[model samples]
Target: MTTLNTHPTTAPATSAAGGGGSLRRVLWAAQILLAAFLLIGSALPKFAGQSDAVRTFTDIGWGQWLRYVTGTVEAAGAIGLVVPRLAGLAATGLIGLMGGAVLTQLLVLEPVWSLLPAVFAVVFAAVAWDRRAESRQVLRSLRRAPSRTP
Candidate 1:
């Protein structure tokens, strides 16, 4: 006669890697990489060449200064995303900042290039949403009463 053990397994299965914490971490890494690329590629150029970047800034007038401000914001947000405690807030700020970028491109001028900022905005928003869900789950688990073993 064989006895069957009904106890739940304590260890997480390797196959579960794609489902929870691993998934969150992977998404965070991708978000950080994308943010860095945007900050470097567009923001850096703006600060490096005020006249050229201001041409794109248009009616805003303070174009040169605005370029510097946007560039600094992007650089800071990029750094924030990599830090464990600040990742969520960083992602949220990124989403808002990118949204403004996309709107500026659309309303100020119908440049085909405007789509790139829009895409980044959407991607960052999705990353923020995912991280928010994970945080909520953690908080919920913490608040729940521990299970009693019979």
Candidate 2:
């Protein structure tokens, strides 16, 4: 089906890619901004052994290794968010990360700090919802790929 503003050939089976190009652009922009923020404010610090990251991880009682692991996931997810095909899946994964962050904040750090992850969770949910079609398409492709095992 085609609307006056959209052609089936030009659009995908997704809202983020089809009917509302403008919205998709906004979402992309948001994702880019968030990824930049995560890389600079969170991921990089952990990898760099910054004092704040060190302190936070120490407080969490999960050891420095957990900091590295969390940073790795955050960095990967941030990078994934910018890849058109991976945004949905990345957002879905980030939502889980954010949920864990929220719980950690409440239980380990400070209760007030949970707000950040909670807000991130909501934003990720929006991106995941918007890109659901792309996520499904990727999954379908994986399912259709021929097995390589001999």
Best of the candidates, lDDT: 2
In candidate 2, position 50 carries an lDDT of: 97
lDDT of 2 by residue, 18-122 (tens): 557677777888899999988888899999999999999999887999999999999999998998788999999999999999999898889998999999888
Tens-digit lDDT string for candidate 1 (1-150) = 997764333333222224667776677668768867857876787778756677877665554678778888888787767764455567788888888877777777666767987787777676666656444544566789798999
lDDT of each: 0.68, 0.87
| Displacement of the residue 1 alpha carbon in candidate 1, Å | 33
* Each candidate: RMSD: 8.4, 4.1
- Per-model TM-score, in order, reads 0.65, 0.86
State the lDDT at 14 in candidate 2: 43
Candidate 1 global lDDT? 0.68
* lDDT of residue 11 for candidate 1: 31
Model 2 clash pairs?
none
Model 2 lDDT on a 0 to 1 scale: 0.87
